[model samples]
Target: MHLTDHDRAMRDGAEGDAIAAAMDLLIRYGEGLGAEVLCDVRNVAGTSTQPTPAKTIIAKEHGWDKAFSVINLDSDADIAIPPMRVPTCQLQQGFNDEVLSISPYRSELVELQDGAESFASEKGINILATCTPYQVGNLPTRGEHVAWMESSAVIYANSVLGARTNCEGTASTGSAGLTGRIPCWGNHREETRRGTHLIESDVRVESFLDWGMLGYFAGDVVGEQRPVLSGQLARPTLTDLKHLGAAMATSGGVEMFHLPGVTPEARTIEEAFGDTVPATTVHYTAADRAHVYETLNDQGSSTDVDFVLLGCPHASVEQMAEIARLLDGRKLHPDTRLWVMAPRALRDVADRNGVTAAIRAAGGQVLTDSCPAMSRTAPEGTRVFATDSAKQAHYLPAILDIEAWFGTTRDCIEAALTGRWKGELR
Candidate 1:
C-alpha cells in the first residue's frame, strides 16, 4: 500500500507513540484489505467506552490509557493517549444507570460505563452514545469519506447520504479517529460502488413495515453485494429508510444499497448499474414479503408478550412523537413492559415536546445511550418479546434465547397494552 508523506511521518513516530501505533494498525489493515492507498477522512464513529471483560482487566492492571492501547489501537506498547485528531463520536454501549433497578443488568457495569464515558469525553470524543449518528449532529456530506463502525449507520451513510465507507470494525475506526485516514478500498472506489443486483418489488412497499420486509428480502437475495431497487415503492421518509437499512444489515451483510430515484448516488436504474449488468434480478412479490415476515416471526410461539422493544438503531424524534400518539389514552398491561430506545439528544427534544411525558404516563419509557442487545440484558423474566424493528426481531431471539414477534409500531404498542401478540402481516 502507498502512503502519503503525512502518513509516513505518523508511522515513523513523529506524532508520538499512540499516533504511530494507530498508523501502524491502519497500514496493516489497508494491506490486509489489498487497498492501494489510504484516503483522508474527517468523520469517524466508533466504539470506545463499551465495557468488556478484557477492557476491564486491562484498565485494572495498566490504566485506561493502556486499555485504549491494547483494545482500540491493537498495540501492546504503553503510550500516552492524545485527544482525537479528527471529529469522532462514541457509539452505543452498555446500559446507563437509570435502568438498573428495573433491569437485571449489573450495577458495576453501569458504573464502569459511566467512568468510561468520562474518559472518552476527556479525550475529545463526542459521546453520541447512539447507533444512528446521522440523525444527531454528524451528518456527512455526499461523497464524503468516513469511517463508521455500526452496520446500520454504514449502510445509511453509503446508500442514503452518498458518503463512502465500509462496515468498519472497532480497531479500524479507532485508528481512523486519530489519524483521519482509512484504507481506500471497497466502497471508497467509484467503480466498485455500482450495483451488483437488481431487486424489483412487485408488492406495494409504502409503509415502514413493508420497507423493512423488502429490505430483508433484498439482503437475503444478495448477501454482501449492492442492490438497486425499483418498481412499486413509496417515497419513504427518514424513519422508513432507517428501518429498511437496519433490517437489511441485520439479516445479511449488506453495506450499501440504491433505491434509484430515492437515494443520492443514483438518479436512475441505469446509473445504479453503471456499465455492468446486474448479476441477478430478483422480484420481491407479496409471497417474498410474507416469507420475510414469517422468518422474522418464526421464533415466537407464545402469545403472552412480556416485552416490546422499539428502536434497534435508535428512534428519531418523529418516531418518538408517533409512539406518544399511539399510547395517548392507553395504559400498558401490568404484565408487559415497553421501552423506546433513542439518542439522548433526541430524547431531550422528545421531553421538550411532551412526547416522553405522554409515553411515561402510559407506562412506557423512552431510554437513551444503550439498548438490550448491546447490554445483553432486558426486563426481568422476559421470555417473549415483540418489536417493530426488523433488526431487533432478527437478533434478540438469538441474543437472549427469547421469542420475538415482528409487526408495526401500532402492533407492538398493542402488545404492550394487552400483553398478547395479536399482530399479523397486513
Candidate 2:
C-alpha cells in the first residue's frame, strides 16, 4: 500500500499506539484489496457499539469502551483511541427503544444499545442512528469522499449524490473514524463508476413501491454490474430513490446505478457511460414487475394482516407526515400492530410537528433509531405481515418465516385498520 510521510510515520508508531493500530489495520485492509494508495475521507459511517452475535460477550459484560474497541476496532489491546477526527455517524441500532415496555424484546439488548450510544457519544461519533444519513445533518456533497457502511446509503452516495465510497463495512470503516482515510479502490475510482449494462424500462414508476419493483427487477437483471437506465421513467422523489436503492441493494449486489438526466453523476446517457456504450442491455416491461411481485409477496393471497411495518431504511420526516395524514381520524385494528421507524433526528422533528402524536392517537406508533429488518422482535404470534416497502416485503418473509405482502402506503394503512390485505400499487 502507498503511504505518505505522515502515514508512514503513523505506521512506524510515531502517532501513539491507538493511531498506529488504526493505521496498521487500514494498511492490511488496503493490501488485501491490492490497493496501490489511500485517499482522504471527510466523512464516515460505521457499526454502533451495539452487541452482535459475533462480538465477544465478555467485553460487553465488562464495560462500554472495551466492548467498542473489541467490536469496532477489531483490536482487543487496551489502547485509548482518540475522538473521531472526521465527521462520523452511526447506522441504525438493532431494535426500537421506544417499544421497550410495550414489546416483549429483551431488556439486555436495550441496555446494550444504551451503552453503545454512550460509547459513540464519547468517541465524537454523531450517533445519527440512520441508514439514510444524508436525510439528517450528515449530507456529503458531490465529489466528496466518504466512508459509509450502510448498503443503501453507500449506493445513494455514489449513484445519486455523486459522492465517492466503496461500501465500507463495520470493521473497515472503524479506521476511517480514527485516520480519516480508506483504500482507494472500487467505486472510489472514476473509471469504475461508469455504467456497464444498459436497462430500458417502458413501464412508468408511480410510487415508492413501483420504484422498488423497478429496482428489484433491475438488480436481478444486472447482478453486480453498474447499469445505466434509459427509459420512459417518471420523475421520482427522494423517498422513491431511497426505496429503490434499498431494494436494489437487498435483491442484488448492486453498489451503484446510473439514471441519465436523473442522478447527479449521470447528466446524460453518454456521461453515464463515459462516452462508452454499455456491454449489455436489458429491457423491462410491466409484466416483469408482476412476476417480481408474485415472487416477493409470500402471503399467498391470505388477507389477514397481523403486523404492518412501514420503514426499512428508516422513515423520513416527510414520510411520517404522509403517514400521520393518512391515520388522522382512523385507528388501527386492535389485533394488528403498526410500527413505523425513523431516525432520531427526524422523529424529534416529527414529534414537534405533531406527526408522531397523530399516529399514536390513531393506535399506530412512530418508532425511532431502529428497524425490524435487522431485528425481529415482533409481538407474540405475528404470522402475517404487510409492508409498504418492497425491500421489507422481499426479505421479511424469509427472515421472520412468516407470510408477508407488499402494497402501497394507503393499502398498508387500510390493511392495518381492517386486518385484511388488498394488494394495491398506489
lDDT by residue for model 1 (161-233), tens: 9999999988898899889999999999999999999999898899989988888888888889999999999
Report the lDDT of model 1 for residue 101. 80
Error of 2 at 68 (Å): 2.7
| Residue 265, candidate 1: C-alpha displacement in angstroms | 1.6
lDDT of 1: 0.92
Output the lDDT of residue 157, model 1: 94
TM-score of candidate 1 to 2 decimals: 0.99
Which candidate's TM-score is highest? 1
lDDT of each: 0.92, 0.82
Q: Once superposed on the true structure, which residue ranges of model 1 sit more than 4 Å away at CA?
A: none
Per-residue CA lDDT of candidate 2, range 1-426, in tens?
779998989778887777777788889999999999999998999886645754537445666656656666677877776788888888877664668765777777777777777778888888887888888877788888889998889888888888999888787788888888899999888888899998898877766778888888888888887888878788888898898888888788888999887778889888899967789888878789788788777554678998899977889889989988888788999999999988888889999999999999989877777676676767567889888787788777777788898878888898899999887543
